[model samples]
Every structure is written in C-alpha cells, then in structure tokens.
Target: MKSFGQIIKANSVGKVVDFDAGVDRLLPFDFTATNTELTAAMLDDTELFSDWINKQLANNNARYGVGGYNEHRTIYSRSAHFDTSEEPRRLHLGIDIWGPAGTPVYNFYDATVHSFANNDNFGDYGATIILKYEIAGYVFHALYGHLSLASLSGLAENKFIPAASQIGALGPKEENGGWPPHLHFQIIEDMHGLKGDYPGVCRFSEGDRYLANCPDPNVILQFDF
Candidate 1:
C-alpha cells in the first residue's frame, strides 16, 4: 500500500484557502521562542498579536501569513488550555493560514463530513470540522479548525462535499478561541476514533508519534511560494 503522504501527493487537491501561490505572496511566520518580536505581553493580548501579524504581512507584501507545522511555538503559553502538570503542549501539528476573519475555507478533495462541533474552550478550536476521505483504498481525515460558528449551523454528518467546495469561513478572535483570525488545517492518517477534534498540539516528547499520524499538509496544499 502507498504511504499516506505519497497518496496525497499523487492525487490532485484544491486550495483549502483560496489564494494563488503563484500570484500572491505568503509570509512564513515564526511563533517559536527564538522570535523576539513575540513578547509575553503581545502574545497575551490578542489585539497586539493580531497587529503584529498584520505588520509582518504588510512589511513582507504578503497576502497571508502561513506556517506552524511541527513548530515549537511559545504562543501557547498565553492559554492554560494547553497546560498539564507534566508538560505543556507547545508543538504545533497543523499549518495555520493567518488572514482576515470570514476568509472562506474549501475542501481539497471529495469527502463526507465526519463530524463537527464548537469546542468553546480557551485556545481550543472554537468551531471545528472533520472530513473523511477515501482515496486509493486509504482512508484518512482532514480537520478545519477556528471556523466561524455559523459554519456549523446547517452542517450534518456524512454530508457529501464535492472537491473545491467551500467548507467554512475563518472566525474572528471573539469566536475562534480568542486568538487572531486564522485557519488551522491538519491532515490526519487516522482519527483515533475521535471526531470533530483531535490533538493539534502535543508535548515535545510525543512529537514523533503525532507527526507520523499527521502528515505535512503541504503535500495537499501544494503551496509553491
């Protein structure tokens, strides 16, 4: 059997977020501890963090700020939701597309709605959608998080969504777990019997296992920029 990443690379996928990588510039953002620009105060204040994101895009002449896959992000310190007695989950497992709220997110392949929910926890994926895809005898899933609550209003499980169809819109800070507007996109080889949500971050020690289950989304994103 072909590997999950290989299967994704073999198939044709659509843009999860509408943008022409060839025409529009995408900024690679760094939320790791090395980025001195992300001060503690700035990370705690959503408005300040958002302003900083916009500034980065504006200065770089980019349409959207992207990145965070397998990143050891310090920004999670602002929220206790990621904390535990043993260790905090600081390693990001998804690619974030930082842009304005209400930005449309599309399904990259033909799929059925696996599950949907409003997580509502601080630093959580406020409105989440998980889609199931079966390609070349391999079954896997994709997760879309930080979505507007309205996106879940009429959605139902097992709803057939055609490729390139709009799935939902990015939510504002007030709705998207109180962070800057962005779409959290992740590709999962297995759902682990979980629905509507999965670990988008994990402890640094668990990075290997989590990363294996969650492949690099760029294989499907195909962002040339």
Candidate 2:
C-alpha cells in the first residue's frame, strides 16, 4: 500500500484559503491522532493511519475539489467533528475537495459499483455512487456522495470503475445533495442495512454505532492535505 500524501495531489494550484492563496488547508495526521477523544483503533493505532491516502489525491487527469470553504461554502468537515455523543454527525468520513461546479472526479482505485441512487435531499448526497473494492485481502467499499446529475444519469448495479477512471463530477450547492457543494467520500467495511445510501448524518445518540461502521476517510486518502 502507499502513503496517502504520496498518492494524491492538490486539485487546484494557487487556490487560496485562510492565508494561503490557491492552496487549501490540508489536513495532517496529527489532526486526528492528537485528539484524545478519537479511538486509537479507528485510525490505525496512530502509526500508519491506514495505508489509503491516495484515495484523496487529485491527479492532473483528475480535478480534486479545491476549497476549504473559502471559495465555495467556506465550512469544513473532519473526523474530529464527530464526538462520542449521539449527535447527528460526529465525524466526516471523506475528505471533501472543494472547488467550482463541474469538476471531474476519479476513482481512487479499481472498483465494482455496489449500489447507487438519487438520494437528493437537504444535506444529503444528491446523486450517490458506491464502489466496492478490496485491499490487503480485506473486502471493503468506497462511496462518492454528492455527485452531479450528469454523473448519476443512467447507472446500474455492479458497474465497473477502472482504476483512476473518470466516474463523476462535483455538484454545486443547488443540488449536490443539500450540502454547500462538496464531495462526501466514505469507506465502509459493512453496508449494514444501507443499500442505495447510508447514514452520513447520525443522531447524537447513534454516534458510537456509526463510528463503528464508518472509519476515517484518511484511512483511504492518507493525504494530510
């Protein structure tokens, strides 16, 4: 496996955020490790942070969403946001690459389309796509929520997304699943009862349960950025 930072690249060059122009606020490993509340097991025991950072990178062939809410919504999502409480959402499963509308997104790796649907709603993945794959002999699935209508048009079960294939594009705030325009990428070990969509938002009471089913997106996209 490769380190997350080594696999993914900055989606947009010179995109500024906070104080840096043309640069998004990248996330470092310590952001999750240093947090006392985060369970050690959830993040690979604080050493490697699960070898899947490439999942978050943006190749030139690919256009990563490039905004830390400065250009788009200016808000942020992170695992640290999830607490032990049963609040609606305790953590952010995927790294949102914020950029303008119509940016193309690529699959981090080869995958089989497990399930997809138009789960459009306020704060929901308007057009969601979930791809199943395996790593280290372990079966898993990666989901791309909040996709554009063009991305979701005419899909089927068990679709194939070749490694780095252009599968979808970033949606705008008007219909990108109710969010202010960002991608919600998540890694799941088990689908549970979820079929076309899964619970990205949880009640504070179910925080612990969701945390178990969904791990950190960094586990796949190890990029601290």
Candidate 3:
C-alpha cells in the first residue's frame, strides 16, 4: 500500500488553515538543547515559553513557527508524562504550529468527528479532537491537540465536518496542558481503534514503529517548514 504521505500528495486536496504564506514564510522552531534560548526553567514556565515563541516569530517575521516531526526534544524532560521505565519519550511525532491563541484550525479534508476529550493533565493535550477520513480507498485519522476547550463542545461522534471548515481554536496555557499556545497536528495512518487522543511523542527505541503509524503531518498542514 502507498504511504499516507504519498496518498495525500497525489490527491491534492484541501488545507488545514487559510493562510496565504508560502513555505519560505514558515519559521523553524528549536526546542532542543541546541537552541541556546531554551533552558530548563523556560520549559516549565508557560510565560517564558510563550515569550520565546513570540521572539522567534518576530525575529523571523513569520506567521508560524513550525517543525518537530521526528525531532528529539529536550523540552519533554520537564514533564514526567513522557518518561517511561525503560526509555523517555523525547521524539516528537507531530508538526507543532506555534502561533497566537484562538487561531482557528481547519480540516484538510471532509471528515467525521471520531472522538474528543479534555485531557486536563500537566504537560498534556488539554482539549483534543480526532477526525476520521478516507482517501484512496484507505481509512486514516487525524489528531488535533492543544486546542481550546470550547472547541470540543457540541462535537459528536460521526459528526460531519466539511473540508477547510473551522474545527477549533488554539488554546491558552491553562487550557492547553500548560504549554505555550500552539497547535499539535498529527496524521495517523491507523488509530488502532483509539479515539479522542493518541501519543504525539514516543521513545527513541520505538521511533520506527511510531513514525510509520504517524507520518509527517506536513503532508496535511502543507507548511514547508
């Protein structure tokens, strides 16, 4: 079977946002140790992280700070949520869009609401929504996390959401699992029947398996960075 990324590339469907910027306008954000601006203190402080993201946007004159697909980030160490007995989950499996809170998020294609929930935990995806889509005769799912809690309201299973429709807004720190305001978008080739939520980060040892299931979200977001 063709990979999800390949299928999406051939279809030439819709987009996740209504932005008019090209890939050049997209800025790359670094949350790893190589980013001299980041520190242990900043990772745990929402205000600091938000300020850092703002700086990145202003410095680059970009509308969005993107990247982090398959990236090994040191920021995950701040939360025990990613820590496992054997290995830590430092590898990011999604494309994070760093932008202002309340930025509207749209669906890349027509889909049905698969599930949603307010996973109110420290360093977690507070409000999340998963959409089920079928393309090229294959069924797949998309997970939108770190969204405003209000977005989950009125959502029902199997609810039809039109392509490019406003699905939700970027959430605040308190509502979005205490992180800097951003959208965590992931493309899942298979959900394994899971709903409402899925792991957006994984351990290094499990990178191959998780990366296979969760392909590069840029295929849907279409942001070059």
Candidate 4:
C-alpha cells in the first residue's frame, strides 16, 4: 500500500487557498524563537502582530505569507490555550498561509464533510472543518482551520464537496482565534475518533509522534516556493 505522501504525489490536488505563484508572491514567515523581531509584547497584542505581518508583505511586495510546518513557534506563548502546566505546545504541525481576511479556501480533493465546528477559545481554531478523502485505497483527512464563522452556516456531515469547491473564507482577527488572518492546513492520516478538530501543535518532546500522524501539508499544497 502507498503511504499518504506517496498517494498525494501520485494524484493532483487543488489549492486549499487561492494563490498564484506565477503572478503573486508568497513570503515565508518565521515565528521561531530565533526571530528576535517578533517580540513577546508584539505577539501578545493581536493588532501589533497583524501590523507586523502586513509590513512584511508590503516591504517584500508579496501578496501572502506562508510557512510554519514543524516549526517551534514562540508566538503561542501569548495564549494559554496552547500551554499546560506540564508542557507547552509550541511545535506547529500544519502549513499556515497568512493573507487578508475573506480570502477564499477550496477543497483539494472531492471529499465528504467529516465534521465542522466553531472552536472559539482564545488561540483556538475558531471556525474549523475536517474533510474525509479516499484515494487509491488510502483513507485520510484534511483540516482547514481559522475559517470565518459564516463558512459553517450551511455545512453538514457526509455532504459531498466537489474538488476545488469554495468551502470557506479566511476569518478576521476577531473571528479567527485572535491571530493574523491565515488558513491552518493540516493532513491527518488518522482521525483517532476525534471530530471537528485535531492538535495542530504539539509539545517539543512529542514532536515525533504528532509529526507522524500529521504529515507535511505541502505534499498536497505543492507550492513551488
């Protein structure tokens, strides 16, 4: 049997977020501890963090900022949602495409709505959706997080969603878990009986385990840069 990455490479998938590298530029962002420019104060204030994001794009002449898979991000320190007394979940498990709010998000493959929910906690996913897919005898799932609340209005479990269909739009800071507007795209090999959400970040110690369950999203994204 082919692995999920192999299956993805064998098949063509659509853009989870509308982007054209040929015409539009994508700036890779760094949220790791080494990026001294992103101070603890700036991250704690959503407006400041958002301003910094926009500045990077403006200065670089890029349309969107993208990155954060397997990254040890320091930005999570701003919210208690990602931290526990025992461990702090700072290692990101998804690829984040940061852009303007209301940017359209599409399905990468023909899929069924496995689940949907508004994970409204501070630093949470906000509006989230999970799509189930079966390809070449392999079954897996894709998760789209930080979506607008309106995206959940007419969705239902088991609903057929065509490839490249517009399923949702990016939500604003107030609605998208108080972060800069971005789509959190993750590929999960197993749902583990979870619904509507899965851990998009893990503690540094558990990186190997979480990274296995959530493969690199770029396998499906196929972005050139």
Candidate 5:
C-alpha cells in the first residue's frame, strides 16, 4: 500500500483551502497547534475565522477532532462534562470543518460514485455521497455525508470522480440537519457492497472496529489540524 503521507496534508493547507479560509486551516485545537504557538488572531472567532473547538462542546453537539493531542475524542467522552445523552462519546471519526453553506467540496482522489442518498432526519446527515477509489493498490472508499440538496440533484451511482474533482458543495444548517455547515468525511476499507447508505454514526460498542478500519482521513487529507 502507498503511504497516505503523499495523499493528504495536515490541517487545512490544501487546494480547497484557497477557495475559503473557512474551508481548511490548521487550528490551535491540536497540541501541535498550541506547540506552534497560537496568535491573537487565532484565538479570536469574532471574525469567524478561528476554530471553535474546545474541551466543552458548543450547542450540545459532539466534540470531535479537538483536544490536547489533536487526536479523536468527543466532549461527551471527557469526564468533566455532565451530559449523559451521548454516551461513549469519544470524539468523531471525521474532522468537522464548520463553515457556511454552498462551500465548494471536492474529491480528494479519483473515485467512482459507489452510492448516495438523501438522509432526511433531525440529527441525520441531510444528504450524503459515497465514493469508491483505489490508492497504490488499496481498494477503499470515502463518504461525504451531510451535503446540500443541490449537491445531490440528478446524481447517480457509478459516476466518475477524477482526482481533484469538485463533487459537491457543503450544505447549510437548515438544509443539513440544523448543525453548523461542515462535511462529515469517513474512510472505508471495505464497503460490504452496501449502496445508498452506510453508518456514519454508530453505537460506542462498535467504535474500535470502526476506528481500526477507518483509520485517519487526514491520512489522505494531510490535514493535521
């Protein structure tokens, strides 16, 4: 297999970042970010450019991809918190880059539309797209959940995803299940051939299995932030 070091970048320093700062940037959320030394501008979010990640989750939503190590673990998983609704909450499988709607999203590598569907639910990913690809002989897949309706209009399975292709735009809160606009990206080694649906969120009991198979999307994204 090829080393993901070649496919992804750390934090948000990628082609998509140029389109909008909100799209990607290495936040001081990780230990390395703090080690790099945070600037006054990085601490201020009034401009809406700084990352809102913290030990305490904002608006009862799960905390993901933030902490002292920049490792995976949710606010609910932390012992200091008092919320019981989200048990086994140890962060998330994907990095959530909060931003505005209509933010352009693209394919990280060449892939084919494995499956897709409009998951309409209160806390569900509004619209999702699953793409399959191969890297250095490793067959794998990526899921882009919580996309906008416009992103899925007229889309079909088996569609082509050339490397660096623009697949769709991010959805707003209203259209994307009332959360801040962000892309829920997850990597899959084995799709099990399921189509139009897969579990982006699962019970804590299955966390280990998912984490092992999922690995770090940043492995390909190269976004260490």
Candidate 6:
C-alpha cells in the first residue's frame, strides 16, 4: 500500500487554491529566535503580531504570508501548549496562510466533517475543524485551525462537504487563540482517533517521524511556496 503522502501527490491535480489569481505571492515567514523581523515585544500582542505580518507582506509586495513546515520557531513560548518539562515544541508541522480575518477557507476535496472544537486556551487553535477523506481505500484527514468561532456553527459529525466548498472563515485575535488571522492547514495520514484537534507542532528531535505522518499541505493547497 502506498503512503498517504504518495497518494495525495498522485491526485494533486485540481486540488485547491488559486495562488496567481486569488492569492498573491506566498512569503516565507520565519519565527525563530534568530529572525529579527518578529520581535519578542510582539509575542503576546495579537495586534502587534498582525501589524508585523502586514508589514512583512507589504515589504515583500505579497498578499499572503505563508510557510512554516518543519520550521523551528521561538514563537511558541507564549503558550504552555508547546512547552514541556522535556522539550519545547518549536517545529511547526502545518502550512499557515496569513491573510485578513474572515477570509473564507474551502475544502480541497470531497470530505465530511469528522469533528470540530474550540480549543479556547491562550495561543491555541480556537475554532478548529477536521475533515476525513478516503481515496483508493486509504483514509486520511485534514485539519483547519485558527478559524472564526462562527465557523463552527451548525457543523456536525459526518456532514458532507463537497470539493471546493466554502467551509469556514479565518478568525481574529479575540477568537483565534489570540493570534493574527491565519489558516493552519495540515494533512494527517492517521487521526490516531483524534478529533477537532491535532498537534500542529512538534519537538525538533521528532521531526522525521512527525513529518512523515503529517505531509506537506501544499499537496492540497497547491500553493507554490
């Protein structure tokens, strides 16, 4: 049997997103301590973070700021969600699309709502949605994090969601775990019986294993990042 990543790549044609028409250039964002662009002062303030992101986009002449797959970041320190006695989770596992709040997000392929939840902790996922997809007898999952609270309304388990269907909107600071609006997109090879939530980051030491299970989201988003 082929791995989930290989199957996704085989059917990558007609996936989702219009980078040239709807989306602008996809900027590579760095949140590591070595990156001077994102200051420590901006860590707790969502407004400041959004302003910094906007400036990065403006300076680059891009409409959206993206990247952060397997990236070692220092920005996770604000929340205990990424911290542990052993190691801090700084390696990002998802592809984040930084854009304005309330930007509509679409399902890339035919799927059904598996679960939804509001991880209301500070610097958490806020309103999140997970969808399940089956292809060639192999089942996989997709996660959309940092969504508007309103996006979770009326969602139920196993609800059918068509390809390219507008599913939810990007959330703002007050509702999206106190961060700038962005879509945390991830493809999961296995849910591990999880729902509505999954680790979008992992420790640097576990990069190989975590990355193998969570493949590049560009397989679905099709963004040339």
| Candidate 6: segments with Cα more than 4 A from true spot | 12-18, 21-23
Q: What is the TM-score of each candidate against the true structure?
A: 0.97, 0.61, 0.95, 0.97, 0.66, 0.92
> Per-model C-alpha lDDT, please?
0.90, 0.55, 0.87, 0.91, 0.57, 0.84
Candidate 1 lDDT over 1-225, as tens digits, reads 687778877777788988875689999888898999899999889999999998988999998888999999999999999996578999999999999999999998899999999988989999999999998888889999999999898889999999988989999988899989999999898888898899999999999999999988888887764
| Candidate 3 Cα misplacement greater than 4 A, ranges | 22-24
- Expressed as tens digits, the lDDT of each residue in 1-225 for candidate 4 is 677888888888888877777798888999998899999889889999999999999999998899999999999999999987588999999999999999999998999999999999999999999999998878889999999999998899999999989999999988889989999999898889999989999999999999999989898987766
Ranking by lDDT: 4, 1, 3, 6, 5, 2
User: In model 6, what are the clashing residue pairs, if there are any?
Assistant: none
Give per-residue CA lDDT, model 2, range 1-225, as digits (tens). Answer: 543223223221111111232453443322332444334443433122212222333332223433121111102232333233544243444556544466677776667889888876544677888888754445677778778878877677887767766788877656675444456777677997578787665544555676566666654454444
lDDT of 5 at 124: 60
Candidates' RMSD to native: 1.0, 12.2, 1.5, 1.0, 8.4, 1.9
Question: Which 10 successive residues of model 5 have the least lDDT summed?
Answer: 74-83
- Clashing pairs for model 3 are none
- Name the 10 consecutive residues with the lowest summed lDDT in model 4: 13-22
Sort by TM-score, top down from the best: 4, 1, 3, 6, 5, 2
- Give the best candidate by lDDT: 4
